[model samples]
Target: MTPEQNRHAAQLAFVASGAELNIGTPEECPLPVDQLVATRGDEPYVRERFSAGLTAHVYRIHAQGQDWTLKLAREKCKVQNVDGQTSFLNEIQRRADLRHLKHDPLLTDRLSAIVDTRYASFRHGVLLSPWIEGVAIQAWDERQLLQLFDTLVALLLGGLFEWDLCTGNTLDDGQVRLFDFGYMYRFDPLRAFNSNGTAMPQFHAAERFETRQYFAHLLRLEQDGERLALDAFTLEKRIAVEAYQGLRAELASRGAAPVVLDWLDGIIATWKRALVNDVSELYLQEAWRSHWLDLHDDLSGQTCTPSTLARIGWLERTARERYADVQRLVVVESKNRLFDQLREARQLAQRWQVA
Candidate 1:
C-alpha cells in the first residue's frame, strides 16, 4: 500500500483499537485510569492548566513524586480540519514509533531530545509523559540550531516527517527538545521526501522548520534592520546547508532512490551557490514563501492568531515597498492587485482570531 493508504489504515486501527493501543505498562502510569479521567486543573495535584491548545487540554500534574504532563483530548477540536481532528490519535501513533527509535543505541543520545511517552490510551483520550521544565526559545543561537537540526536529521532518517515545528512544540531546558508529534507522520525515508511521498517534494524537513518557526524569528529580526535579518538568515542557511549535505551522504549510502538524492543535491547546490555570492535574493524569496505559506496554513485551519495578522502586515508592507523584489522571486503581474488581496486577507485574518 502507498503511504497515504497506510496512514488511513493506521488511523482506522487506532480508532478501533481503544485500550489495545495503550503505550507503556499500567505500572508506569502516574495515576489510575479512572482517577486520571476525573482530573481537571482545579485538582490539588494539577500544578498548571494550559487550556489554549486546540486539540487537547494539557496539565502539569504532580504525581508519584514527579511532575508529568497530562494531555486529555478535547471533545471537539477547534481547527476544523481532518488533520486537526485526528491529531491526538496521530500523536499517540507517532509516540509508539518514537519509543522504539529511542531504544536504538546508535540514536539513543541524539533522539533523547524527543519526549518519551509514559502512558497513553486512545479510548480514554489521555496521554501522559514526564513534564519538560523548559522555556520557549527566545532566540536561535548556534547551540539551539545545531541541536534542533541534529534531532531533525535523526527523525527524518528514521522515517518520521514532522510537519509542525512551531514555537509551542519546541522547548529548551539545557537541550532543544521536540515535545509535540500531532502533525508528525511516517514515511519511507529512502524512497520518499515525506509522508506524502515524492508528490510534495517542496515540503521537506528544513522547509517545514523555516516556514513554521524560524522565518517568524527572522521576521522579527527584519523589523530591527535588514542587515540583522540577513546575517541571521545567512547563519541559518549555512547550518541548513551543512545538515542537508550530511543527510544526502547518509541517504545515498543507504541506497536512497536517485530521485531523492538528486532532490537533495539540487537544494544543496542552490544554497551553496547563494552562500558563495549574495544571499539577499535567496533570503527574500524564501522569506516570502515561508510567510505566505504559514499564513495560508493558519487561514485554512480557521485558527488565526495575532501572528496571522502580523504576517499579512508583512505581506502588505513587502508588496508596497519591495514590489520589484517579490515580483522577481514570485511572478507577481500586478503590485496593486497583490496589495488589494493582502488587504482582504488582513480583514479575514482579523475576523478569524481564535487565539
Candidate 2:
C-alpha cells in the first residue's frame, strides 16, 4: 500500500480502538445529562424533534427561557458504516479543538458562523448548543458563496478540513452557518490539500462543495436544461476561482510547500482557461464526477436515499448514451474499468437502497 493509505489505515484502527469517549461537563448544558436523557418523547421541554440527522437525534428544547439544540448520539447511527460508527467520537474531538480556539479573538471572528458548543461528551452521548434560527440554503447567491468561501479559506488555512458540506450541515440565517463537525478533521494546510495530508489531491475544498451540494443544485437546474445549469456552474466556478486565488496567495505567504502551490496554480489555470475558452465541457466533467462520487458515498454508507437513486439512474442512463464522451474525456485509468465500476455501483445501490 502507499504510505498515505497505510497511515490512514493506522488512524482508522487507532480511532476505532481508542479510549472511551470523554464526558462533557454538565455546567455547559442547562440541564444535567441524566435529566436530559430522561426527558424524552412528547416531553413539554422539547419544542421540536428532528429525526433526520444520520448520527444523532436532534431536538429543539425550550428550557431555562432559551432555545437550545440537543443532539444525542444514536446507539446505532442510521448510516450503517464505519464512518457513521465513529462520527460521534470524531465530532467530540473537533468540538474540543474548536473550543480551545474560543479564546483567540481572530479565530473567534473567523468562526462566527460555527455554532457555539455549549456541551459535548462522547461518553454521555449528547451535545448541546444554542439553537440557531436559520433555514437550509435553497439557492446560492453571490453573498452566500462569498461568506462560505471565507469560512472555508479560514478553516483550510487553519488546518481543518470539513469532509461533509451537505445541505443539512449548513443553514442561512443572514449569513451561512455551519453546525456539524462530525466529518471535519485536522490536516497540515501548508503541506496538504486535506485531512489526509498530501494523500488525496482529487478531494479538496472546492471539490467537496461541488460533490456534496453544488452539483445537486445543478441537477435541479438541469430540468431547465443545459443553458441554465451551465450558466449556474460557470458563475460558481468564477467565484471559486477567485476564492482559490486568494487562498493560494495566503497559503504561499504563510510558507506553503511548493507542491501545494503548484496544485493551486494548476486548478486556477484550468478554471481560468475554461472561463476564457469553452466552459461546457468543464461543467460536464465536474457534474459527472460529483454525481458519481456522491452515489459511491451513499452506497458505501448504506444510506441510499431517493437522491442516490436519482444519481444512479442518471449515471446508468448517461453512461450508455454518452459513452463516447464519458470514455474519451473522463480521466480514468481505463474506460473499461470505469464502466465496470459503474456496474458495480449500480449493483451495490440495488442491494443497499434505503427504503
Candidate 3:
C-alpha cells in the first residue's frame, strides 16, 4: 500500500480493534446494539433479505415505525482482494465523510441523492441506513442522467470518488439515489483526478459510470440496433460534457493544479469534437475501452459472472469482424493474439461465476 493507503488502513484497523467504533449515536438505532449486531435477517423486524452482495448481507427491517437497511459484513468477502476484505470498513469511513460533507451549506441540496447513514460499527461489522423505496433503473433518461451527473460533480469537488456505479448500486424513486459506499474512496479535490491521484487519468467519474453501468445498457441497446446504442451514447456524452465543464470550473475556482485543470480540458475537448463530428468512431472506441477495462476488473476480482463472459464474447466478435477498425484504435497485439488471450479469459470467467 502507498503511504496514504497505509494510513487509511491503519485508521480502519483501529476501528476494528475492538474499540467499539460507532459512527452515529447508539440512541439513534431503533434496536439494541447487541440485537442489531447479531441479526441474521430472520428476526421479526426483517422485512426483506438481500444476500446477493459480495461483501455483505443486507436486510430491510421495520423498527421504530420506519424501514432501514441493515448490512452485515460477510465472514469471508467473495471478492479475492484486499479491497474486498476492507470494503465494509471503507464504507463506514465514507459514511462518516459523507455525513460531514452533507453538513456543508452548499452541498446539502446537491447531495440529496446520497443516502444518509443511520449508524455503523466496524467491530460489529454492521451498517445501517434508511431503506430507500427506489427500484433499480432499467433505462437512463435525461432526468436521470442530469441528476446523477449533478451529484457526481458535487462528490468530485467534495473529494470523494465512487468507482462501482453498477446497476445494483443505484436506485430511482422519482429521483436517483446512491445507497452504497463500499467502493468509494477519498482523494484531494484540488490535486487529484481520482482516488489514485493524477497517476491514472484514464479512470474518472464519467468513465467509471460508463464502464461499470452505462455500457451494459448500451450492450442491450445494440441488440435492437446500432442506432439505438449510438443515440444513447450521444445523450450520455452530452450530459458528461456538461458535467465535466462544471467540474473543471469549480476545481479551477478552488485553485486546483494546472495539470488537473488541463486534464479536464482535454477530455471535454475530445467529447465536444466527437459530438460535433462523427460520434460513431468515438462510440466504438469507448465501447471497446469500457468492455475491456470492465472485463479486466471482473477477472482480477475473481468475481466473473455471465456478464463477464458476455464482454468476452463482444471482444472476440469485435476483434474477428472488425479487426481493421480495432487496429485503428491502436490495439498493439495481432488479432490472433487477442483471440488467444480472450479465449483463456473466457475460460477463467466461466469458472469463476458466483453461485
Candidate 4:
C-alpha cells in the first residue's frame, strides 16, 4: 500500500476499534494519506511500522519539518469507561506546560511542538511531540556519568526537582532534560513539613518520598563512619545503601577513580546540607560553584584502578552488613509486637469461650 493509504488504514482501524481518534483528516472513509504527509512534512520520514510501547504503537515521524514522534492508542486499550478523551486532552495540556517549562536551563530543550488532532474516522487518539535525542544518563562513561549526576542534583535544587529523578528517567544532551512529567510537582522544602513530621510536597509524592528515603539511607551510611558490623536492625537500610554502592563500584571498576568518587562524596554532602536547610537552590549552586569545578578538575583524567575497585567492593560489603543489622532489628521488633497482639487475642478468645 502507498504510505498515504497505510496512514488512512491505520487511522480507520484505530477509530473502528473505539479509540478516541484525535488526529486524522475528516470527510474521508479511511482518511487521506496525503493529508497525513502534508500535516507532518516529509523530513524525518514516517516510520512504516508502529514502534511497540506499553499501551500503544508509536511512530517516529518528521512532522512540520521537524523530528517528531507520534503515539496512537491500540484498539484493545479502548475499553468502555476508559477516559481516553480526558487522558488525551490532559497529555496535550501537560506537554504544553512542559514546553513552557523547557525554557528553564534545568529542563531539556524541546525538540518538536506537541500536536493533538483528530482526522476523519480515525478512532485512536494521537500524541505528537519532538523526539528527544541523547544518551540515557545511566549509559554515560565515568567522567560524563559523574557530571550527569551533578547536573541532576543541580536541577533538583534549582526548583525543577521532578521527585522522580533516577537512572531510568534522565537523559544527557550536554545537560539533562527530564521526561515523563506525568508526576511532576513543585516542591518547597521549608513549607513541606506537616505537623506529624512528614514531608508532603505538591509534586510526585511517591517519587519524592523515595528520593528522601534514599538520601536518608546515604546519611546513615555516612554516620556509620567505620566498617561497622551489621545487625538485623539495620539490614534493610544497609541493603539499600549497598545497592547504590555496588553501582558505584561497577562504575569505578570500569574506570572511575578516587577523585571521581570524592567528587560524588562532595555532591552527597552538599545534597545533605541542602536537605537540612530546606533550600534546593543552595545544592544547585554548590554543584556548579567554583570549588566544585576545581574538584571536578582534580578528578579529571583520573581512572579507577584495581585497588580503588577493591575499596568500592569493601564499601558495598560494609553497607550490606549494616543492612543486615537493621533488618534483624526490624524482625525482632515485629515479633515482639506480634507476641503481644497474640496474647491479647488469646485472652479475648478465652473469655468468649467461657461466656
Candidate 5:
C-alpha cells in the first residue's frame, strides 16, 4: 500500500480498536505537541530518551499526573528498506488490533500482556502509552518462556500473528510485556497456521521465539559448554511442548479446522517425544533451522544487527564443524550452495549492519 494509505489505515484501525475502551484522546493528552517536539531531553515533565527505537523518537515523560511513553515518528525511519519505512504505520495498525482485543473479558488479561496504546495520531505522527519500567529480556527462564508463549497463543487464536519477537521488543518486570507491533499482522487463525499459511507450518509460536530470541541466546552460551546450551534448549522445549498442547486443546474446542489442529499436534508430538526420550537431536535440528531462517530474515530486511553477525558466525562454524550432523538432520536443500550463500551474506552483513 502507498504511504498515505498506510497512515490512514493505521489511524482508523487505532480509532476503531479503542472505540470500546475510550482510553484517551489526543485532546486529553497532557503533553503539549509544540513543547514535546521542542524539548530536547528530559523536561520538568520528561525523563529519558529511548533512542533504540528505529522508526520513532521515544521518550519517557510524566504527564496527566503519571509517567508515560511518548513516541514521535521520524521523518525517515533508520531501518534500511521498505518494511522499515512503513514500520510506524504498521505498528499502529497492529496496536489498534491488539488494543481492541481487551474488550473480551476472557482475553482482557491475557492480551493485556501486550502494551496498551493510550493515544495515537498517524497523521500527526505521535503515539502515547504508559511507561513500562522493565528489564530487557536477556535470559529465558521457564516463567518467561511460558508467559511469552501464553501471549503468542492468545494472539494466534485471535488471528493476530507477531512476526518480530526480538529481545528488544520484549521485557520483564514480574511479568513479560510485549511493547512493539511493527512486524505483527493479522491472519485467519482458524484457516491458517500463521500468516504464511500451512506452507510453513514450522513457523509457529514456539518456533518463532526459538528463532527470533532463544537460539540467539543459546549461540552466545555455546562457548561456555555444549551442556549449558543444550540445557537451555531443553528447558525451553519442555515449556513449549506444554504451551502447544494447551494451544492445541484451545483451538480444537474452538472448532478450528482439522488441518490446523493436526499441524499443532505434530509439533506438540515431536517436542513431547524429544522431551521424554532425549532432546539433543531436536536441539540441534531446531538450532540449525532457527539460525538459518533468522539469517535470511536479517538479510531480507537489510537490517543486520549484532545478532545477525552472531548468527552468521554460528552458520559458518556449524557448516565447517558439523556438516555431517546437518546432513543427517537434512536441514537444507544443498550444503554447497548454502555455504556459498552464507559467505555472500557475511560480506553483505559487514556493510549493512543497521546503525
Candidate 6:
C-alpha cells in the first residue's frame, strides 16, 4: 500500500480495536516507522530501544541534519492498562507548558513541540523529542563535579524551584544539566513546613553515602593542603539526606526496611556533626585521608584487605537479590491491579454490546 494508504489503514485498525482517538491531523502526528524511514532519504541512523520506565519502544535517531528520539507505545489489549500512555501525555503537556520558562544553565534543553501519534497502534500512542548527550552528574570528574554542585545549588535556591534533584536525573558535560522534570513543582515554604515541620532539607542516607564517595574522589584531585570546592555538594547532600531519612523512618515504622532506617540515622548524625561544626571540609579531607591510609596499609600487608574484585562481587550479589524481590512484587501487583482493571472494562463493553 502507498504511505498514506498504509497510515489510513493503521488509523482505521486502531479505531476498530477501541483505541481512544487523538485530536490532531495526520501531519501533526508522528508518522509510522515505515513512513518515517521512507521519508528520511539518507539523514540519520535510527535504533529502537526501551527504557526502564516506559512501555513504549524508543527509537534513537542520529542524523547529521536531525537528531531526535522517537517513542512508539506498545499495542494494548483489553486486558492491559493504558495508564502509561496517559502519563506520557500528561508529561508532554507539562513540559510544553514550561518550555518558555528560562532554564538554568545547568538544565537540559527540551524541544517545545510534541509529535503525538495516538493512532499509530491499536491501543497506544507515540511521542518525539530531542536527545540530550552527557554523562550523569554522579559519574562526572572533579572539575565537572564542582560545576554540577554549584549549578544544582543555584537552581534550588534561585526562587520557587522544584524538580527531582537526584543523581539519576542530573547530567554533566563541563556544566550540570537537570533532566526529567516529570515531578517538578514550585517550592512552597508552607508545604515544606507542613511536611517536615521545621526540619532542614537533607539527602537520603543512600544518596549521602553515594555522594560521599564522589566527594572522596574530588578530594583526591586536589594537591596537598588545597581545599576542594565542595560547599554546595556538602550542603545539598545534608539537606537531601535529612528529607530522605524522615521519609524512610516513616516507612520503616510501618514495617519497611528497619536496617536502612538505622543506617540513615547514623548518616544523619555524621552530617549534623560535620555541618553544624563547620568542619564538613575537614571531615571530607579526613575521610579521604583515612581511605588512602587504609590503601597504604593494605599494600604493606598489615591486614588482608578485600580486593576490588571481591567488593564488586559483593555489590553485584546484593543488587541481584534486591532486584529479584522488587521485580516479583512489581509484576504481581501490576497484573492484579492494572491488567484486572482493563479486563473488567472489556467485559463490561462486551455485556453492553450483547444487551
Maximum-TM-score candidate: 3
Model 3: lDDT of residue 22: 70
List model 3 lDDT by residue over 201-319, tens digit each.
Answer: 89999999999989988998999999999999999999999999999998998999999999999999999999999999999898999999999889888999888888888888888
Residues 1-355, candidate 1: write the lDDT tens digits.
Answer: 8667677776866676664568986677978977787787899999999978889999999998999999999998888777888888899989999999988886788899999899998778889999999999968988899999999999998899999999899999999999989999988899999999998888998899999999899889888899998998899889999999989999999999999999999999999999999999999899888999999898888888888888888888888889888987886659778777788878888888985
Report how far off residue 321 is in candidate 4 (Å).
Answer: 6.8
Q: Give the better candidate number (1 or 4) by TM-score.
A: 1
Each candidate's number of clashing pairs is: 0, 0, 0, 38, 0, 13
**Of the candidates shown, which would achieve the greatest lDDT relative to the real structure?**
3
Q: What is the C-alpha lDDT of each candidate?
A: 0.89, 0.82, 0.89, 0.37, 0.80, 0.40
TM, every model: 0.95, 0.91, 0.96, 0.37, 0.90, 0.39
- Backbone clash tally (model 5): 0
- Tens digits of per-residue lDDT, candidate 5, 1-355, equal 6433564466557545743322357577777666665655657877888777778988899877789888888888877665677677777777778777878786887887888888876656777888898999877888888888888888987788887888888989888999988777777787788776666777877778878888999988888998999999988887777777888888888888999988888888888888889888888899989988898887877778888988988888888888888889855747789788888999988878876
Tens digits of per-residue lDDT for model 4 on 1-355? 6332453454445435764423323432122344343433233366544432323455666544555555554544321222222333334434555455546663442222212232322333455545666565423333443443444333333333343333334556665545443223333222222111123211222224223222222324435642221221133223323333443454455555464455444544543454455443432232122222222221221321232222233333433444344343232234345345434533433333210
lDDT of 2 by residue, 129-160 (tens): 89999999887888898889888887887678
Model 3 misplaced regions, further than 4 Å:
1-20
Which is the better candidate, 1 or 4, if ranked by lDDT?
A: 1
Between 4 and 5, whose lDDT is larger?
5
Candidate 5 residue 164 Cα shift, in angstroms, is 0.3
Model 5: what TM-score? Answer: 0.90
Q: Between prediction 1 and prediction 3, which has the larger lDDT?
A: 3
| Weakest lDDT window of 10 consecutive positions for candidate 5 | 15-24
Give me the displacement of residue 81 in model 1, in angstroms.
Answer: 0.6
In model 5, the Cα lDDT at residue 14 comes to: 56
